[model samples]
Target: MGKHALLSASASKRWLSCPPSARLEEQFRDEAGGSPYAEEGTAAHALAEHKLKKALKRRSKRPVSDYHCDEMEECTDGYVAFAMEQVELAKQECKDPVVLIEQRLDYSAYVPEGFGTGDLLIVADHVLTVIDLKYGKGVAVDAERNPQMMLYGLGALELFDALYDIDIVRMAIYQPRLESVSTWEITVPELMEWVEMELKPKAVLAIKGEGEFHSGDWCRFCKAKNTCRARAEEYLKLAQMEFKAPPLLSDEEIVEVLKVADELAKWSADVYAYAQDEAVTKGKKWAGFKLVEGRSNRKYTDEEEVAQAAQKAGYTDIYKKTLIGITEMERLLGKKKFAEILGKLVYKPQGKVTLVPESDKRQEIAASTAEADFKEE
Candidate 1:
């Protein structure tokens, strides 16, 4: 597969929701190299693919030495185990179940120049399952009504529907770092219905560059988010709101403002960072802002020499020792081995209460329960 498809399944959530974004993003050139986070994620995926393929006795000719790391090994091992569990479950239901690793899926029928690689695909009697490995911990991806996974399902259906008597499609997102394994199921007919109705129209508009720009949470990952006129207008509406003497706002108004504030803050920060980079690195200047050296602390030219001089001066107090962090210890010993050895020594305390939006997935604590717990303490 090509490095990037114009309407790539990964960005389906953004472009499908805001069809005009596909064309708008094409106007700007992407940064030359991937971000550190993207590179880490890519390495993790390579390791996961290697592990899975090795387990299946389908190892690639390419060496996995460059991608091998302790953390990557652990994360990929978990992903492989989870995927194998799903395959085993499928095996129980079908006479011959097949698992495909890093399978290239084509969704061009529903999206122009769209395709994505499924980390794992399992096909069994009247059922197809698509598993995706997400190494990033920035956001928890849900499988429910996920357009990306749905498009993958469509691609898998195009490839295997004729071969297998598939009726149900299962989409799973495995984020091992977050300990999240979310799965959602839909009938083949329902998926096809969505493709025929919602997907095809949007895909056509996106490909033709003939749709209106609408901003929401979907703009979070859009390349043009920082400078998008629609987003600016949306946030500007909130900024232009009438300011009372005490800045009193109705509950409904507060809710509306809160919804836009998060995205607005992120956009503002992104714009600032982009402008700073342009000014300092590319010799481009903004009208009001000038680049300057950020605050930093002085450091010794040679730490070893400084340490020797300090010790020779009878500075014994400079030295200290401490136990390794729990996370580092667990990493060194391996999670299971560490838990087996020191399970009883570890204790988890109740986390402090914090305010969050109602949409947060965490269960809310009752006031009575909090009072009762405090009394017991």
Candidate 2:
């Protein structure tokens, strides 16, 4: 097995939903080097592990040498502090609490050849808590029914069941960048029931490469997502719809078309990005597309000297003092502290109304507002 398992816990959400995705991805080699965001996440994880180890007085051979940065330091500190709070709570409920950081967890019983490192695990009496620190800010991850966290909980239970009697499993996602901490709890029996009914069957088909290819939001991070035939067919299905004038379609039909149009736009962007990467980096070319410089802006070689010259030429308004943005101010003061200091001062205006599918989590506008707006005026 490589650094990451074929049926990795992090990718459980994808494979469980689209069983063939695991086997499909094996056909292509991962691109060289890591994305900047991924690298930053790794750095934040390293710092968090180091900080936690130091707090527990455990010696770690690895050092946060290359991953040391101000932002990472603060982010990891926040994670360690939050995890310690959970640990303290567990300690209060039980006589003794066992805390482990950066522990290797194995879930081969449920997933074929699966294993992953858990960021933090605390076992006390009948409660087993798994805390995951997500440094990425792109999306907010919730713990409720999250396949990844459930897999981690299973692995933790497998490792410590012999020593501890764990009945309730609590999974938490601590996304410091998004200032979100979501927790979900389930009985151990319920979790195991899911493993037997849902996970095991999917793993069996996925390991044998005998499952159908289904696409959804889970395809966002797949290596072959841009070129996957299933996804291409899905987009093509949208294209096959008749191009009727907008005014002729009913309200319901318009909503359906809008959904398809959104997906088509995203698909086109993904295909374009993939083609650009292939042509520029791997020397692969499409029949009609050629790589060329898009645009550029002129820049001064010596910024300080240019500024001095500009000032000498009577350019005094070139620089101005601007207050830092709310995000940056919050980062500097810490999220909780910032809220305590300015919670009353900050007012968030209501966002513009948007049309979304029923599956969207946001609450729909009040029927009274809709009725008033459409009052036959």
Candidate 3:
């Protein structure tokens, strides 16, 4: 853990997974420009905070909807709506609503050691609530024992301790994508214990950057993917696999064969680029072995004319009704059904996109569209 440790939700996960890499990244985060997605998330959170404070000031609970709020389009809208409703309900139903605050600030331990930013912290007469809005639909957040929320709760209690007689501090993870809210009622001692025992130690280790690479699906999105030694070795070994068709080559021969294949692949790419450039500069059209000067793209024009001629011959749709590529397949099968077939009908471990049986897919289309291949006359 360094002085510039990121005390955010994502930081914890990264620190635990790859401490060295996380430390390297975090230490140089300023040099690494902020991600667009992060900027969007921050913008959405700001909007939500503003709306909540506005609702509190007016003593009215009005729903805040963001039509073009891209950062929060996924979960912010729904979570913000639910939280506003809860605040309004608290005012209307509860005995006395104390304070509805936007960005009620708090910190863990001390500034250099532990620090956190809360999305929203509300303090009532008898209860304290901290709400975190998560926009991602991929992972559902649970508030119970959530370190991020726990840290937020700790900060809130510390800040508002002297101001109000806070009895119970409740934390909530409001996920709009799931249309769900999970709450955790924690005592002051329990929260303190969690922070000191679990969060602080973890935070220390994270700051120090002492973790191992625990491989998982999320590795696909990790920045260290290309440079990771473990991944590179595994991929190299996998690539070296033989066809097993014949045992014609010895160990040395096999190595040589692979080297030749690798070299050929690189050479082929370079040659292709050179040939394409020369053909263009020399004013010669090249397709396969055929070459012509001052003329290019003959095939597409010729094909169009042939298609028109075929139409004249009373053969319509003559662009060759070849097996539609995957893109066209997706267009033909709308998003929902295509997803169903892709996930449910397809096999696992190898989550490959697969087409369902013709009859089944057609039946799905018929049911949804209320017609079977309804081509206009």
Candidate 4:
């Protein structure tokens, strides 16, 4: 909890969804060394900050990091270019538009000690914009009504709302790895309306650690997700659906089941992982479970030695080569170079049909698309 508030903006999605989870999360300690993904993101942010500051003719030193690579280099360059465009636009509104990089913003008026560092904050008379850089590719982050970005908006407004005659607040997320750039804009009055009604109430409940626990997609990153009773009951309710129905689940029941199918599998895996960790590390054995060796395959301790031994034994046809994965290739060549070299040669096949909730951003494939596939098969 070094810099993490009990109701931090980053975990607002989880805490707001299940307010009591803020207190529940306090029971679990942070992972000792943090995760590689988070560290990589930090490195990328540091580099991006240096690049943006330099672009603005500010004094800053370029930082060296192990995570520096062609992909990061190109992405940060793109982010700096985007920041420069915003700066140019701000200059149209005022002669001296202030640009702040890696600034701490406070929103304690709404959230208790609710503050988060914004990646970039640009100020002008007409508009105030806060931009964030997302370095991960696992999931696309949209700024539309995003709790993290909105909180940052509140924080930024708190800093300069009176100083600047700002009518609109713009929050943008730049996720280059996913080829996503999202911006959500709201008038000051409209933003305050949401703050007074929704965000404030949620923040109050979260700070008090008082509210009914509701489990949903928000539980994905909750610290207590593995053992939370509310989550267990949510998934268990789906199992109970089998007996509650007559002989088969009706259409509505089936639809409800489909909604939580992915979450159900995830919950099971989380429980299994927790149980294994407890048994192995804490020696807390389950009633009917015991630790045992898992399946393994033999591997060469040193691949070079293995290759030499194989060649010495007259094994000439030992290796097979395949084209590198698209992501790795892109990183190797940089985005611009990759496009110039192999853009036309690349093609994407239709993905296998899968069911998802209506809220998913992907457009629904035409019924004829699946029907045509069936006919071909």
State TM-scores per candidate: 0.92, 0.86, 0.52, 0.94
Give per-residue CA lDDT, model 2, range 207-318, as digits (tens). 8877889877788899889899998898788667676788887888777677777777877899998888889889997998787888999998998998899999999777
Candidate 3: where is the Cα deviation over 4 Å? 1-5, 16-22, 27-36, 57-77, 88-104, 108-113, 210-377
Candidate 1 stretches with Cα past 4 Å from truth are 59-62, 65-67, 245-247, 367-377
Per-residue C-alpha lDDT of model 1 across residues 1-377, encoded as one tens digit per residue: 24888898899988888898998889988777868778788888877887788777785653355645666678889998998899889989897798888899998877887899898899998999999999999889999989989989999998999998999999999998898999999999999899888899999999887788898888878889778898888788986877554368776777777777777888788788778877888999788777777899999999889899999998868767999988888788887888899888988988666556798899999988777777767
Expressed as tens digits, the lDDT of each residue in 301-346 for candidate 4 is 9999989999999997889999999989988887888999999989
Which segments of candidate 2 are over 4 A away from where they belong? 57-62, 65-70, 298-324, 329-347, 367-377
Q: lDDT of each prediction vs. the true structure?
A: 0.85, 0.86, 0.58, 0.89
lDDT of 3 by residue, 172-253 (tens): 8876656667888888777777667666665666566665654333344445543456544543553576645448657775
Model 1 accuracy (lDDT, Cα): 0.85
How far off is residue 189 in model 2, in Å?
2.0
**Pairs of residues clashing in candidate 1:** none
RMSD of each: 2.6, 3.6, 13.1, 2.2
